[model samples]
Structure formats: C-alpha cells, structure tokens
Target: MPDSVLYSAELPAFDRATGQLSLAAHHLISAPLSFLDLSPPGSTLLFDQPPAHPYQQPVLVDDQPRRKRRRTALPSADASPADFAALRDKRDRQTTTDRESDEHHAGIALDLRAALEAVQQGWAGRARDEGWVGARDDARVQWRLREAQDERPELDLVGLAAAQERQTVETPVRLEPPRAHLSAAQLFNRLVLNDSSSSSTTVDVGIETSRVEPAPPALAALLFPPRSGFLMSDLSTWSAPSSGIAALGHAKGGWDVVVIDPPWPNASASRSSSYETFDAYDLWNLDLPALLGDKPALVAVWLTNRVKFRRLVKDKLFASWRIKGTAEWWWVKVAADTGEPVWPLDATHRRCYEGLLVGHYIPPGTKNVALPTIPQGKVFLSTPVGHSRKPVILDLLRPYLPSPERAPNVLELFARMTLAGPRAPSIDPLPPPEEGKAGTPPRCGFYLAVGNEAVKFNVLEREGGAVRGWIRQSGLEKAEAAACVPEGQDVERM
Candidate 1:
C-alpha cells in the first residue's frame, strides 16, 4: 500500500461465467454507521462476568463512568431446599476444561506483554518521529475521533444467498443474502493492483441506478433478492486497460503469498448485526492449493482467540490444504488514547490480542524455492480501527518470503475495506449518470482498499491531524471469550 493514492471509486466484482460485473454486494449498507464510523466509541468493558480469581483487581476505565453490573436474580428465602441445591450446582458447573483454558490464556497474555515490552524497548527511540510502528512509551498516542454527519449513497441493490446449508428449515426458510455477483476466483482475478509509486492513479467504475428502486412483486427486499435483479447494461463501462488501471496484469499469476481470512462464526457479531458470519465449511470450499501458484509460497490465517477456532485452522485446515505449518504470531490491540490494550491483559473472559497462524506452503515435487523459516511467538502492537478490523500485517510477514527482490504477489481471500476514497475540498462531484448509463468516476483522495464489500466501510468520515491510525486492514472480527469454548456464549472487542 506504500506510495499509493486511494480514490473514492466503486469496486465492481466480475463473474466470468456470465461475463458480467455488479456492485450489489458492496452497495449501500443499512446497518448502523456507528460501528463503521471513524470515531472510536467510548471504551467499555467487553465482559461483565467476574474474573476467575476472587481477589481480582478493580478495572478503572478512562474518561468514562464505571458500568453498573447487571444483577442476577437470586433465589428467595422462602424457596424449597431443592431450588437452593439447583442454584448452587449451576454456579459450580464450569467444566474443568474451561478452567484450564482460562488459566492457560491468562498466562499467555503475561508472556506476550513481556515479549512486546522487549521489542518496544529496542524500537522506542526510532518510532517517535515516524509513528508507533511497533510500540512506544509516553511520547505520543493516537486517539480516534468521529465527525458528526452522514454520507449517504444514492445507490442500492439486492442479491440471492446462494448458500444452501444443512440447518433445519423453518416454516419459511430464510437464507441470508450474498453480497457479490462473482465467484471468489473471478473477483480476485479482476482486482486491480495500482502501485502509485511514480504517479497516483484512480479507476472509477461508477454505474447508474434509478432514483428509487421500483419494488418487484416477489418481496425482493424481505426475501432473497433474485439473481435477475441486475441488468447487463448496469455493469461498469470499461475502456482500454492502460486508460484505467495499468498494473492489473500481475493479479493473474499464482500468488507468492496467499492470506486466507474467513468470516468465522461469532456470537457477538450475531447479536450486534454489524455483519454476517459463516461456518468453517464455507471457507473449506475454496481450494487453497489451487490459489497458490506453483511455487513455495507462504500462507497465513487470522485466527480468533478461541482454541477451537485456532485448532480448526492449525490442525485440520492447514494440513488438509498442504500448507505445512510453521509459526504463530499475536496481534495485540492497543488503545490509541491510552497507549494500552483495549481490553485488560489478564481479563479472564476476554483477550485484547488475536491469533495469526503461518506456514511455508511448499507442496510436493516443488524444489529450490528456499522460503525463510518463520519465527515463533511473534507479537505486534497497533491501535484498533472500525470495529475489530484486523490491522495490516503483510509488511510484517513479508520477511518470511523466500526472496525480497521479487516483491511477492499477495492475494487476500476475504477483504472488506471500503473502496471509496476521501473527497478533497477542491474537487467537484461528477454529475450523476442517467438510469441506464455509466457515470464518470469521482475525483477524491483514497485509501487502498481491495476485496469483497470493500466499499461497506465508506460511511466513515475522516479525522483531521490524527497521528498513527492504521494504514491497511484485511478481515477477521472474531469475538469468543478469553479462553474455553461451548459455542454461542462469547463477548467481542469493539
């Protein structure tokens, strides 16, 4: 993302099967803009449950009132003996496995803090001028602030869920609709790699839509939106290659590094309705080996804090996909305001850090490609942005690649950054196109966002003169409890 000029432009995903492109998946989102807002909300405790130890230290939040804990209903004094026994049994029913996992993770956080502090001590002086790349002391801190207004889109679309899971059907089966018109491979191929080292380039793929969608007879808004919802004429009008995006040629080759980020199932994400989450099988459908070009490439997966989620990737997914596992790294979220972890380091039920699993994906019969051995237990500190979006760590992982001269071709399996750019004060808005015509691309400053729903986060307005905000973020917003698993009972980090 270095030396790139990100512009506010529409990202059009293409389907080679029908040779059509659509923006429906990345269209106007009706969800709360607060989660996507540039301003970080007042930090609150993610877990309300008491810490594992009886003598746990009190946590005092900064610039915010302490939240009163919700009281559990107690058994009345007149209740039967049987009722009292049941209540006591339920209280002590936490499984042995759960207790062990919680204890294990609590220890892991302590070690991670120690390791991060060591790295910070070494890089503290140099990091002051450039920004907090790794870690820092009391010199400077970056706080997220939000602008008060709305940036509404004049366009919208609806599409079918496409997935038919085995879950039991209700009286009327409800399928969560999909966002893209193209398959993953087709979309990945169509992604434009714009390196603005010499000159800044922006390719706007603007299309026209009716002022208000004429509702179809099938209840398209309430039900699965039909595939026939889009017209061929609605696709972006593409000119010659060099005229729009020049360096798009490299997206074809087998990627030297493939980063797989799935929408892992999360309890918190479900309750919040921020975005949709999918099962692990949905991720398995993507043939991992096929994506990596015939070379000894590196593969990394962003993991949630849960042991089950970690095991799914490290145990089954990696081995089955032929990505020989190597090492693991932890991305600890630091609060820009406090220069401390967003969550308490020793909080029993929540973790400030998430997991990253890496490996050298050298398949059988491939030789002479000497990929570097990834060091184990690595940690990086960076402030969180926009609701637990994973920070850009490709630069950190680049060192593990076999060769530095040949900048590795990186492919993100699941990307959700906004493709739209920030409009500068001097720029004028392009006239909206007629209902059937493709419009001119808007002129604006931008962030380099590529992948699915890349425009979903566009609603966020920028903060002026803020120091050390994250540059690039890919995917993964998992929120399980600190450790242990029973599924469907975890909290999230905001």
Candidate 2:
C-alpha cells in the first residue's frame, strides 16, 4: 500500500557517482569499520581446549622393553589374573572420560543458546522504543499522500470495474493474413512514400525512441557491466536450464561476494502475487560452494523476521555452502516522506525492520585463518520503497570485503531487476574516460542474473535505462539526460 502514496519531495537523493541512494542518517553503515579499531577477541575458553579422544591409547616401547614384551606376550597360557584386571580398568577410565566430555560440550552449547536469546530480546526491546517507531511525527507523510490523491483521484471499486470493462471491450481481434501478401516492390514503394510524406512523424518517432532508448552506458556500467558480465536465468533451473555455476567459475577471480534475496513463500506474499515464491528446502539444491570458488568469499542473505526462516538460513543453508556466519545486520525501514517507520515497530502484520545475515565462505581442507570479526546487531536505517526492494549496501559491505580497492568480483543470486538500476542505452560504445575527467562517475561494476523479467524492468526504470522494442504505456515521461559508457560491454546470457 505504500506504493499508492507518492512523496517525491521526500525521496532520497541519488548519487550519480556511486549509482546509489544517499540515506546516510543510519549509523550502521559505518559501524563495521569500527571493528578495525579494536583487536581480535581471543578464542573462546570452551573451544580452546581439545575434546578427549574416544579411543584406546597406544604405548611406546624402548629397545629393551620391546624385546622383553615380544618374548613375554607369547606366553599367554600362564597369564596372571592381574593382566585382565588392568584391561578392565583401562576400559572403565575411557568410558568415564567420554561421558564427562559429552556433558561439558552439552553445557557449552546450552550457554551459547542462552546468550543468543538474550541478545535477540535486548534488540527487540530497543527496537520497540526507537524514536523512528514511537516518537516521530507522521503529519508530513499524511499531508503528502493527501495532496497526491487530490491531484490524482484514488481508484475505487467502480473505477476498477470500469477499467476492466474497457480493457475487455478494447481487446483487438486477430485478423487472418491474406493468402497472398503484397509484393516486395509494392511494399518498398509504399514505405518510401510514407517516409517522404511524414518527415515530422519520423522525427517524432526518433525522439520518442531516444527517450525510451535501449540500455545506456551509464545504466550498464552501474548494473550489468562488470568485467564478468551478468547471466539471467530461472533459479529453479539454475543447474539444468542454465550454466549459472559455469559462468561464475569462468568469471574473473570467481565471485568474491554473493548476495541473495530469495522470494520466500508466505501467506501475504502469496496473496499479493508479487512473485513466485520458493520453499526453503528448494534453496538447498543450489551449488553454492562451486559459485563461491576456491578462495574465501563473503555471502550475505536477506531474511524475513520469521524465526524458522532465519534458523534455516543460518544453520542448513550456510552449512550446505560451507560458509560460517559472522554477523547479523538489521535494515530498519522508515517512511520515505516523514522518515518514520512504514508501520509501528510492534505492528503484528509487519515489522519495520528486516535482517541481513553475513557470512564467510571457507573451502574444505583449507586453513581456518582468522579474519577481522564482523560487528553484530548493527542497524541500517532507510526509508521503505517498492515491495521487498532494499537500498544499496555495497558501500557498507565494501569494508568487509577482502579487496576494496580492486572492487571484489560480485554476484547477485535470485536477483531482482530493481537492484540492477536503469535499462542500458543501446548506442555507440565510448572509450573509458581519462583518469582525471571532471565530474566523471565511478563504475559500480557487478554481475547479476535474474529469473523474472518484471524485476528486470523495475531496475532499468530506476537506473534511467530503457528496454529496446518495448513501448511505453504509462504516461510517465522518459528521461532525456544520458549516462554514457564505453560500448561492446554486453551481458552474457545463459
């Protein structure tokens, strides 16, 4: 319903240089950087000591003992009763040690669970009382919504019915083609005459095409023009219908970071028909380890507030991918117009905050070298936009990446189009700008593969890109200003 309210005046400022929106009021964006200021915490006491071995101990023998033991061990016919007693004692000690170790580990696991619960509770309490939720005024948001509605009448049931009727009545019938079509000469002559007669019409068409032009360099550079280009395919058939994994493997240095925003199935999302949702179990089929490549990589996932979903992602999903979770970040959504939460903090149907779980991928048989610990429970505040559309967090994530300067080879899975920016312009390719060009924007080069075309459309529109051969139905005017980039940089579709 937030989409129905237009508050263009309060929209966040878009940074052309970064190809990202500036919503810097949130403190979480810079919190991770503070980790550099502190030393790494020592290993936990519970995990520092090794667990007792559950098998028999081996005895070493000296030269004299080896000869004596070999000679004495053969004479078992006259063995003493003390020999059997010694064996029984050893077995009993091993059993007792194993039981004690098991109890110790169980206690440690319980302690960790308690600690996690406490943290979650503390966060919930703070969120409930946060000013963005409880104290901020919504007068400005309401006023803007009212003004928008006044300028454009809100649709009611009657209007909806009338619109449906018009659509049904306006449906065009398919006319059968003539058995014999016009000859090529006749067709060519007619086209030439039409072109000559309407010079003004030709110019108007050209202008319209330019306005809704195919992908522009600026849009392509931001969303799809990474050295390793994007591959678009259905995730359900990621393994069969497409070479999603093969593409990643062929990418430059593989994917250094992968971000996934799954279309989680829920009653509300199902009713809205916004997108096709996948069962949590279905995600297990993805070959995440292969996509992560050989080196250590960062993986971030967007999760709903549901406890079961969160548990599944942290436990099963990450485990399958051979990734260990490092941090949990909260994305707190406020109103775009009033900078207040879209809903009350304690709203039963929807919480104003969603979660992002970040983890590191370490390949099997590799040394588990310690990386800088990620700060947990950080909050990123931003105004809500389209359904499930999250603000860009690449800037915030850059610090955590292995290489910030070279720009980590990034990949987005289960990607939505809105994340890709605007449609790219299909025009002549230009050369890379000189190092010191005044007002030249930086490149946000990243690869993306999406299943849904609708998602793709939304991203292009936001980035000021247009789809070729697609006619504009909405009254919204196309953007005239162009963002140019070097040409011949195209996405590799699978």
Candidate 3:
C-alpha cells in the first residue's frame, strides 16, 4: 500500500487572467461552445423544396393530346359478369376522388395549413429577437431553424414539438421550480421520503447557473470528448463515486475506478469564455451530495500544492463522499538532460510535480482495511516528455478496483478512452451533444504548442512560487527599514 504524504508548503498564489500558464494546478475544462451544437435533437432533414403558400396553384406545362379511346362493337351487349364488375370499380374510384377534393376544401384541412403557417411566423419572430438572420421567407427560415434544432441527439422529436407549441401558443415562457438552490436538508428529506428511489431526479437547472472560473494551465493536447449524456448510461466502470467534481456529476455505487485532475480554485483568476474557467458556476453548480450518495470503492483525484484546494478536497469533497484518506503520491517528472551543468539540474522548472490524491469510500459499518501495493514504501517517479504525462505504472492499481459484492455494476467519470480489456469495456468520455442543421464544425479545443522550449512545455509555467520568491528577495524590506529606524539610532550615521 502506498502511504499518503501531506505537503507542508502553502498553496502558491497565481494570476488567473492568463490561462495558457498553469498558475497553480491542472484544470479540467469542458468546451461548452464546442458542444452547443450537440444540444439539438435527431438526424438531419432533407428538404428539396421550400415551403410555399397553401393556395399556390400548380403550373401547367404545354400538354399533348390524350390518346383516342378504343371503340368496341355491339358484342359488348353480350359481355361477361367480370366486365360489369370492372365498370362498377371504375365508378367507385371516381366517387372516391370527388370525396377527397371535397375534404381538401373543407374547414379541417385549411385549419391544419393555417396552424403550420402560424408556426413559421412564430419562429421568424424568435429569430429576429435572437438576431439570427437565417434564410429569406418566414416559412423557409423557420424550417432551417428546425433543421438545425434536430441535430442534437439528446433532443427528442416529441420534446421539440412540444417546445414549438409552447413557444407559439403559450403566451409566456417561465422557468419551472427547483431553480437549483434546494437545501441539503431539502435533499435529505426528499431522499428519506423516497427511500426506495431507483432513479435520479432531473431538474433542469438552466445554463445560467454555472459561473465561469479561471482557466488552468494549458496542456499539450486538450481534448473535449463529448459523450451522450444518457441518464441511464452506467458510469461505474470508470469514475469512483467521490472523485466527481461539481461540474461533472460523480459516479455512485462502487465505480471500477475514478480518475480526475481538478483545477484547484487557489488564485483569483478570471476567464473570458465560460468553458475556459474552472469555477464558473457552469462547472461548479454540481450536486456534490447526490454524486457521492453511494460509496466509491476506488478513487484517484489529482491535486496541486495549493494549500486551500488540498484542504477543500480533504475536508469538503472527501467528507461528503464518506471516503477515508488512504494513499498520496507525487508524479515526479524531470528533463532527460537533467544532469547538464549549463542549466539547473531540475531544468523542467515549470510543472515538475503533480500530487495524486487517492482514497476509498467504504460501505456503512464495514471494517475493510486496505492493503498495501506489492512494491511499497518507495515513492513512484517517471520522466514525462509531454505535459500531463501520467505514469503508466499507475496501472498496477487496476486489480484492486472494486466490483459489486453480488452483481457487477460499474461507472467511471471524467475519463478518456484507454485500450480495452477483454471482460471489462472502456467507457471513456461520451460523444458531444448534437446541434442544429448548419453543419458548421465546432471550434478546435487544442491550441498549437509554439516556439523552441514549447516542446518542453515551458511556456505553460506560471510566474508563481519561484517568481514570487525572487520578488520578495528584491529588498523592499530593507528599504522599509531605512525609513522606519530613527537617524540617531544608527550612531554610525555620523
């Protein structure tokens, strides 16, 4: 078993204004702007012609003469009974055609067409309000909008149709209750009342609830793997129940494993885009209690040397999940040419170390002492050529990952795809939510690494701990002393 080590250093103060640098910690960012298109429902629509007026007449082209009818002799008077039946069928067909024409002209068909026309008009009004100048005519524009709406896989046709009806027919659109500030007491009460609750309650806390926080330092390749946010998808295979943060929900029950690298909220940094920030309410409005409602068997959370955030993970996050502190490890990365005297031994000065905060959430009243790893007592170290290079040696921890005592159910949260194992499937990040019909590709998530030492991930270093240390040594304290001490106190002043 790896022993947990606590750091005595205070968390470094950092500036959040500049995101390319890791002011203090590694932050997990969800690119919502890129995922916006994933919100609409359904497959794309194929529209060959635009909507026209209901009464528009079909244009008639120059027509050829109809073929002359064949004439039969007096033998027709002696025709078989089959011939009479054919004549009767022809009469019925003619009568049905007449009835269809009559139905089309009646009030019902006209009413349906009028409703469609009103829907188009309503959509046009909305587009103008939103400043989306799409398409020419009101009807055509609305169709294009609907086509766009259909792109999100999460949006069902029925829900969309209902939304359309409400937008047009219902005079006002007001938000419903559970505007997300439900107290802990309220939540506990609800849980108790519904003791045998099987499913999680979904209250639409609007997009506004998320407050953007500062962006973490940049990585070599930032990836936003969008998966189907299916309520029923089993998440236990990857993330542990307690490892989940406020933005991304946690895994409940015994997750096979939980892996996370959080953007510690240490510095007073702010971000321009909501997606870039770590604590923007968009990411933090998560229901922590609900996420850890069940005990997580295995967990691994990434931490920084930042003192405040480390305390937060220990006191707040862990306590809520009912997980006990187990082992802590440092991921040490040094430059390959670390021995060169021209540069300092620790040439990779910027992001040299990351702390892995590992723990386990046991069931109520269970006395299970976690055993040590086979090779223990020594710290694990690796030389990472890239930024955020996690040691593959950590894979040794895979075996102890928990399975259900009786039946097997697993979930993993905030994960990337790993090579698949035979029995267990790799449930990494889901696909991005679908968007509207425009087919415009979302913006790129990874910024290209530029310059010479860019390969060494140096530009991402923030001027924090070391830089602050240098500033403190620059003699502001000595200058203050000169002003404070009386001139006569220094008798040597003569």
lDDT of 2 by residue, 388-438 (tens): 555556655655665444335556677653222111221335567678863
C-alpha lDDT values of all predictions: 0.41, 0.41, 0.28
Estimated TM-score for each candidate: 0.52, 0.47, 0.30
Per-residue lDDT tens digits for candidate 3, residues 1-494, read 11111111111322333333221221111111111122111111112122121111234456654443332222278889888787776557755434443342342233223322333333344434421112223221112222343321211212222232221111111112111122111211011110011111112211122353453322111011111111111122112232222112222222334455443443322332111115422223333334434444556667665545555675677766566645554444322122011112122222334556666665556675553322111123222322232333223344445542211122223222111111221234435656853222211110111111111111111233211000011111111110111111232331
User: Roughly what TM-score does model 1 have, to 2 decimal places?
Assistant: 0.52
C-alpha lDDT of candidate 2 relative to the true structure: 0.41
Model 1 clash number: 9
Superior candidate under TM-score, 1 versus 3: 1
RMSD per model, one decimal: 18.5, 23.7, 32.9
What local lDDT does model 3 show for residue 26?
14
The count of backbone overlaps in candidate 2 is 15
The candidate with the higher lDDT, 2 or 3, is 2
